[model samples]
Target: MYVAVKGGERAIEASYRLLDAARRGDPAVPELQVGQLQQQMRLLVDRVMAEASLHDPELAALALKQAQGDAIEAVFLLRAYRSTLPRFGYGEPLDTARMRASRRICAVFKDVPGGQVLGATHDYTQRLLDFGLLCPDAGHAVIQAASGAPVPDAMPSALAALAAEGLIEPQRPSAGDPEPPDITRVPPSYPLPRTARLQMLARGDEGWVLGMAYSTQRGYANTHPFAGEVRVGHVPVEIVPDELGFPIEIGEVELTECQMINQFTGSADVAPQFTRGYGLAFGRSERKTMAVSLVDRVMRADEFGEDRTSPSQDQEFVLPHSDNVEASGFVQHLKLPHYVTFESELQLIRALREAWDARTTVPPRSVEPSTKEVCAK
Candidate 1:
């Protein structure tokens, strides 16, 4: 009997069809609309947008739909789509101080000026599974109350407050004709420019950044960082129209910013001053922002009079490895084709084994015994 070997092309085609079928299950079950996914799964959409560095919610929603809810895949799709888009102009630096905050909290103070607005968070939500959500009868009520309280406006940041009280040293933006380095356009060089550090954290992996941040809490570094401020909201992004030669509001982007105040141990002859660690990202990614802040502080060991023993202190280690897309692609590429290298190793092992066995089993010829027998004859 003869059998035909199948190639990968047919299998790949079949997989695509099966994936399509699986993504769009039962005809009776109403398909999940993009709007529903955008509204209901806003958190996932936010993360995808943050990591992908694309601010368009509608595009992100479409990518989510196309990827069948795979977030990383959705980010990849969004990034690819974003690359094809023409760059009309660059937006003005978003002003976080002007952000319309939905949530704001500070760990350092018991009662801050803004009163810790815990807007929309899952922090206090019960972890128990809600099976009732599966049932159609689990209806919810809507409340219509007369508008009573006026929403509060933007308040002073904690760092600014500290500076006002003279508790911390003031930071001055660069004076004179110094131009800040653009991280997106250029590769980073060490000792990294502050602008490069901010950009890296903005686009860094959430989980990895969180881990690096948590490492400092677990004694990786000695600086005790307090969450000076965490704010989440939308900020207007503006673009300078060339013809108009003035800044115009192009669009808005939701952002999360964390400013951490760390205790500094001053060296001899230097007065101790509280240091600043700043983190800002493009979305409501509070945890990522917080992590970035910690990593930021940890990265400033040399300036803060600390030794660089920890992994977080190593700029080359932390900054380069923070990106997930680059890391994941490089790591996953190992699965492709390495058989030739493995085969070479296998041949070497076999040769070594044969040589060892031959040396052990074979003996030297007895030329002395043969000469003695000949002499006796």
Candidate 2:
């Protein structure tokens, strides 16, 4: 009398259709355009671009739309698309000093050459919900501020300035001609190259990186880092055309750079020098950059004369676990069929229980005569 199961494929297709319909919503209510998302959902777009390691905002918006506004899924989509893009050539190392900065600040200095520009930030706004915005009759008002001031020339990067004065540690170009490990092509190893570390942090999940960074602050490690500089802006990416042999301005990318200064308690006979920590990521991601910079500082414990006793200070611990793609895939795969392993464990439990029951229920064998008594007999 059991009803027959039917229409598995049809049901799945119908479900997909329903999902699509839901994603699109009513035709009367104009569809959410990519541009709308880019302009309005800027933070979400920025996050997707950052995690995807791709700087194209339009592609991020498309991924966002296709993912139905799921940020992680959007990043996955963008990452998948980015993989298909052909690698033309490597660009010159980005010059943070040349960035057309949207926002720039230095915690160490209050009156640097380029005064702190807190441009387009949500930092000062009240967190209270605005019920008025929900009203259909809500109207917008415009306020005026002084305008028309000339955009200032790009200022010297804070790190460069510090290095110039010999107050902070300087990063020497990689010694000898050792080949740098490419994270995209090879699995990262212990004592990872700086390039690999940077790649992992740049594409790492924001929340995960932040949590690891937070652990350091919560006494997991002996890191006292000051945010020396945090800047977000569009920097031009130049490439040398193969045929032309001269560098050509390919395009511009939005980027966030964070530089941190850590105290160096040098070992005996070693001169104390200020240690540097650096983080650079694709797209505007100040939070990720700051978190990564802190992590970078924590990871430099051995080099900077601190003990590497905590997980945060271990390079292998941080880089391998940073990728959301790898983490999510492994986690979600557990949801699939695992009945075989479960059945095996169940059989073992049953056998163990039966053995225990048999041993306990059997009356103790009558004690045999002592060996000494038997021998005497």
Candidate 3:
């Protein structure tokens, strides 16, 4: 055991050294710049930032490089780093209606008011690989806008149309002001509020969220949904300064927003109408946003008075297990030393066996011959 442990320690040290050397590559080769990663690997950086719950691109890029391009590792690093930073005041809630949309589409509408603007998407592209990228080209292809048609600043949501027709449930503005609970500050309990649920879903692992969403579609939640709007764009972030009473734009962040219209049966005074599920995340993460919407819907099964028969509908099951860092940490803890506990268990087992044998064992005793046996002899 000592020799094996020694060998393992040496191997781990060597592996780390090799990793550092490999990260730098050959001396002749130039090291990768974090700026390059931030700009070129924008989508990957965005994902790290979103999952990390921080919106710093440069830090995300640095974490990505240090993690050897592992997104989850980068997110873990970023979250750790974020813990050390001083907290500025919280920003105002974002207004998606005012977003300068680059890409907008609605599954419910064939022709939207602003017209569908497909920008930098592979949705309609062929699945075959292009060999053209292997070769370098000096010239770039130019894409011109439609001759007389001008794209609108924002596309109208199909939900608005449904609401106008009274086919969707009304979302009345809250009479009292209530700030959203910060999960980082205060841990969540069961029956999480909408804000807490959304916060958890926003930073949840993408693959897990996707699976949960897929399960709902496969009849787990028994949901039928239509994409009210899927928008990717830049939205202004604002905050009110202590000195200044009015709010001012701090910056703009690229975001993906999804609104899913779900069917609902009549309840009490409320007629049968459509209800909406919403998701918003940093940058253009369509799948993540869509998954968030679906999970958000399922998590609200109780509010809709739907039966919670699926794992996706269980808040206790989903919320705690969704965090990759927490899940990874707990799972990886199995590799840690458990000798003391195991030795204690072993001792208990041995003692139990001894007692059991003693109880079961028959001791030799003087036998009294029965009258019937004596007669047979």
**Which is the leading candidate under lDDT?**
3
Which residue ranges in model 1 land beyond 4 Å of their true spot? 1-6, 26-28, 137-139, 142-149, 174-178, 268-270, 352-377
The candidates, ranked best first by TM-score, are: 2, 1, 3
Query: Residue 365 of candidate 2: its Cα lDDT?
Result: 82
**What are the per-residue Cα lDDT tens digits for candidate 1 across 44-134?**
8888888788887788888899889987778778877877888876777677788878888888887777678887787888998888779
For candidate 2, write residues 1-377 as lDDT tens digits: 12124665676679799989989989798799999899778888999998888888888999999889988889888888988999866887777678888788898887777778887777788999888878753533422443444546576676667788777887775567466666777877788767678788878999989999899888898777898989888888888877998888878888889998987866786567678778998766888899998888887666655778888877777887888888887897786557678899999999999999998897768888999999999
82: Cα error in model 1, Å: 2.1
Task: Quote each prediction's TM-score.
Answer: 0.85, 0.86, 0.85
The whole-model lDDT of each prediction reads 0.79, 0.81, 0.85
The lDDT of model 1 is 0.79
Model 2 spans with C-alpha error above 4 angstroms? 1-8, 25-29, 135-148, 159-161, 177-179, 268-270, 359-377
Could you tell which candidate, 1 or 3, scores higher by lDDT? Answer: 3
Residue 107 in candidate 2, Cα distance off native in Å:
0.9
Model 3 ranges off by over 4 Å: 1-15, 25-30, 136-150, 173-177, 345-377
> What is the lDDT for 33 in model 2?
96
lDDT of 1 at 157: 78
